[model samples]
Target: MPFPFRGFFLAGLLTLLLISSVQAQSVPTVIGARATLEPWSDPIEALGTLRADESITLSATLTEIIAQINFSDGEQVEAGQLLIKLEDNEEQAQLRVAQAIRDERRNALNRASQLLERNLAPRAEVEDTQARLRQAEAEIQALQARLANYRLLAPFSGRVGFRNISTGALVTPGMALVTLDKLDIMKLDFAVPEVFLDVLEPGLILTATSAAFPGYTFQGEIATIGSRVDPISRSMNVRAELQNPEMRLRPGMLMEVVVRRRPRQTIVIPEAALIPEGERHFVLVIHEEEDNRIERRQVQIGQRRPGDVEVLEGINKGELVVSHGVQHSREGDNVQLLGIASDETSVRELLESRRGQGDS
Candidate 1:
């Protein structure tokens, strides 16, 4: 069938309208930003755990059975505090015998030398007495050392773990008496990817928090960074020292850490302004004119914080960016500047005020 001139004109107009609607892009997307400046700080977040810097398993240096458990489990003990006492009766008895033998030998040697000087004893006999005295002295020292090994004393000031044996129980060498840990100063051990290696080093400050103790922030310093990165994880071990003078922090509590690498003044835009589609990211920048009509311009992005992203390559200062209603306008379409610039300013002010509160 053939259409008349009027019908053909009407069909052409409808087709044009459909094509334009399909190709239209959005404009006036919600926009906001923070004032920018030159600074050099990048904050890297990490997960770690609280741990004691020094921990060891207390064991008997010599073989013996457990006699009396001196310290209670999980008790804070001082340096050289009695932790465990083993069966040492046999050792003490032997030590007494050894002391007697040494004393007797020493006395005999003195008497023999006196007699030799007086020409009353043979020279060979005096020499034999001297030899016996030396042997006896050596035996006494060995016995005293062995006797000291029966009792286990805390090597350093720390908290003792569970008692591994009850009183009168028999234990041997290599048997674990208890665990001890010095928790006054804790080690915050964690790992960071090699990509961030340059930003971390000794003396840098850090703040950490734990869910166990809510709202309490802990402070620390970067004490060590491993020289080599692990091949499997491509991460290097990092250690921070935290003062736990009250001994309130436990040895294995999970932690969250934020290490500031670089601090720089930068322009930050609201995340709402960003329009992400597949691999590409963009934002609807505000185009102001004398007519008060809003227009759109695309922008690139950099890093992101809680609700803002850094402007890396796109946009500039004093330029307005439309954050809300970006899906409605186009490149040259006329838009009413529904609100004043103060709307964007208020949002930025809110974020800064919150940050200030945290600082106080």
Candidate 2:
């Protein structure tokens, strides 16, 4: 090898190293957001079922032929309103006969009393007539009481379901006649894991949603909590009451329930800022001094929401964090901030905007 050739080779190698160092020093552009203190709530989610506040299946207590149907199906009825009538011709005739016998006995007793007072009749004969009058009066009262059963009355104010029996149909004892539901308020029943038993209490506010009504949320409060937890499922039953003025929520509907336990101030950051490496999580915190250098810090994460995550440790309020271009950032690397994300921008919206830019 010649001396001149060796020197030329060394000079070329030094030029290449200088160019690589300059490229590494150039700042990489990234989008970032500042850690913020926000009101955070922990939500307990569970599936629930809706029920009527009051419901019953109306049935007949006696076997009788229906003579008339007083109410139409699905009609709203007030308490004590007559809903059906059975054949009562025989009961009416029996009542009339008992009344006639009662009148005769009363007249005989009065005549005997007057004779005894005038000294024309013995006191023993007047006493026998009085006893007969009392028995007749008892029969009349018994007959009247039996006649009242022939008409069926509503037990409470509610909406009636379709009647199963028509006019002149014979209905046996305990046979279902119709269904009544009190729909002004709805009862929501749900079960929660036993772990949450300590937090369960009456008057906890919750929001419910059903597939039947998309995007509509029904608000309710916890009405009761079960005293005992189920051993098999390790869950406790909870009941909540919701006012249903529109009557749109029906019984047996499956609802998604969300109970916000409590609110607290916590350090929150955009979900995009998190960098997961196996079991550990990290974020790139940017320092504005000295050409905007980035520092990698491990974080302890807590509850996660739609577009943000709760930072339990390793982060502070008002610290700049790299939200976008996290994959391209390295520790101690200089970065140029393209934009500082507003607190209102969600993780989903941020992802969509990045996707759109990639597509263009």
What RMSD does each model have against the real structure? 12.3, 8.2
Q: TM-score of predicted model 2?
A: 0.65
Least accurate stretch of 10 residues (summed lDDT) in model 2?
Answer: 343-352
Per-residue alpha-carbon lDDT of model 2 for 1-360, expressed as tens digits? 799999999999999998998886665778889999998878989999999988998777788999988788789899999988899899999989989998999999899999999999999999999988899889989987887788888888888988667898999889888888898899999999999988877888889999999999999889999999999999999999998988889899999999877758999998989999998999999998767799999999999999899999999999999998898889999897776788586555666787798799
lDDT of 1 at 164: 58
Question: What lDDT, from 0 to 1, does candidate 1 have?
Answer: 0.75
Q: Report how far residue 158 has shifted in candidate 1, in Å.
A: 0.6
Cα lDDT of all candidates, in order?
0.75, 0.89
